[model samples]
Target: MHRVRVLPKYLSKRLDRWRSTTFSENREWFSHLASHGQHPRAMFISCCDSRVDPVAMFEGEPGDFFLVRNVANLVPPCAVNRELHGTSAAIEYAVLVLGVSHIVIMGHSGCGGVAACYDKCEGVNAEWEKNTSFISQWIEVLAPGYERIKDMDGDRSERLSAFEKEGVKVSLENLLTFPFVRAAVEEGRLVLHGVWADIGSGALFAYDGSTESFVEV
Candidate 1:
């Protein structure tokens, strides 16, 4: 196993304090959630990056949102494939079972997976790509944004940020691919949202339904 460092005395103390105090403070809510089951109003599909936690970003408590995290936060259209179906399963449960009224696809800046797609990393073999074929195909959603901004270069950071935001819009569109999700939206039972988080600045931007553009949250 890759061992993580546990040095830094001040950080260690903070961790200990969080474990002891935070766990105790939050345990009651956890118990309540387990007893009553989740009654979340929204389903959040977000990136698997440690820095982009949906619960933390939304200031949500347990049972507040049905959450799904995956590479680049991509939601594949419901397919018959028997392979990994974690994201799809979560969406099914959240929408069909839990009856969440809103579905939010949250993407963020400084996304390694998105960056890899944009850079077109070499040395990745065909077999490896086949194994992770879903990721490769899903990341293609951002191709338009990449094509638009490939030449305009001032800061790589800014360009990547734009790509990340664009990816959120792509995911929002992807959510409509599922028939159930589409029906729900058509009936006004569910709403879809795109959100972009700025990791560098700790700022959030959400797609405005009226403007069809990302605005500060």
Candidate 2:
């Protein structure tokens, strides 16, 4: 039997090189950002999945988007709560404080959190139950898309794609629950978008409000 090396020397050297080059190249810009705080053009709500990095997916540079990530990227309706919640606080700060022009709720294909909501499990953690309550409660959010393609599905891949696209619409509807977010859109101060990214095909889909359809972005 052969044992694999735990930490490769080249990996560490590469990280060191990146730290020096990336930091030096953007040091002045980062310093200005720190001094003035983030004045981002958009706020992106996305899942906490390690594979689904919004900045990398969007090809964004530093301070380009005010990002919030959670188990499923589900935005709960804004309400006063005693305990400190990072996701909600981030949303409030992005909308009210930072005054972002756009709020994009991005859902992706092959989301473990969303899949978990559709399946039953045992010995689930209390924290998971607390955080994922919205996901279970909002089953209607993903139902329509599933229903639409259930009978006519060409293959497993096609069905899964439909499900992910539907989930985006569901999440977009959920975003309207936040009064500040809704009011901002109504007042023409903000715009909302539902986006789906297919990891298998490396394709990006954007929801067209007028046609109520998802188009490649």
Candidate 3:
């Protein structure tokens, strides 16, 4: 027989509170969403950072964005392999099935994942890297940007900040490597956007293609 444990007391309390305040207050909206499948306009790819709340930052409502979060907001070049690729799968679904008009890769300042790449460059072991080592593999997507930024003149902090933005650009490029994404973008069916969040000041900057740089939004 299978068994299921009850939610912890604190977690149950939290759930009840959320239901009362957020869910119950919008029961009709939630019901409509449950009846009709989601058709979000954008796919928001962001880092798995607690402080980086894509919905709140963008003032998005439920079903507004097809969201995918991962370390450093990294998106690997599309590849077909036996191994399961969760991020790529999300991208495929968002593009092919959901038909999201835009894909936004949002990176942020003081990102711990980006910091880990600097650690790798400095030959320092990130705590998670030592035990699982999968983190290193995942962070590998940002490796090229780290290599470019690390050698640049400036303090380590400045280099890391530059890398955080560079990581967004890298992900944007990687998105193009996906055939479906590339086709959609080429045919004017979709748009690719790169954004960086200044976590401390709550400011967002978007990559401007003409300048090849991020500008304040």
Question: Of the candidates shown, which would achieve the greatest TM-score relative to the real structure?
Answer: 3
RMSD of each: 4.6, 6.2, 2.1
* Candidates in descending lDDT order: 3, 1, 2
Clashing pairs in 3: none
| Stronger candidate by TM-score (2 vs 3) | 3
Among all candidates shown, the one with the greatest lDDT: 3
C-alpha lDDT of candidate 1 relative to the true structure: 0.80
Candidate 2: residue pairs that collide:
none
For residues 112-188, could you state the per-residue lDDT of candidate 1 as single tens digits?
87786676533344532554676676666556667666776668778778778777777777678888989999999
How many Å off is the CA of 108 in candidate 1? 1.0
Residues 1-217 of candidate 2: C-alpha lDDT, one tens digit per residue: 2676666999999888977999788889989988987889999988888878889877998889999887666665556779555767887788899999998888888886666543422224343346457655543344444555557647655655666666677667766778887888899999999888877787888999899999998
Report how far residue 160 has shifted in candidate 2, in Å: 3.7
User: What value of lDDT does candidate 3 attain over all alpha carbons?
Assistant: 0.91
Ranking the candidates on TM-score from highest down gives 3, 1, 2
lDDT of each: 0.80, 0.75, 0.91
> Which of candidates 1 and 2 reaches a greater lDDT?
1
1 or 2, which is superior by TM-score? Answer: 1
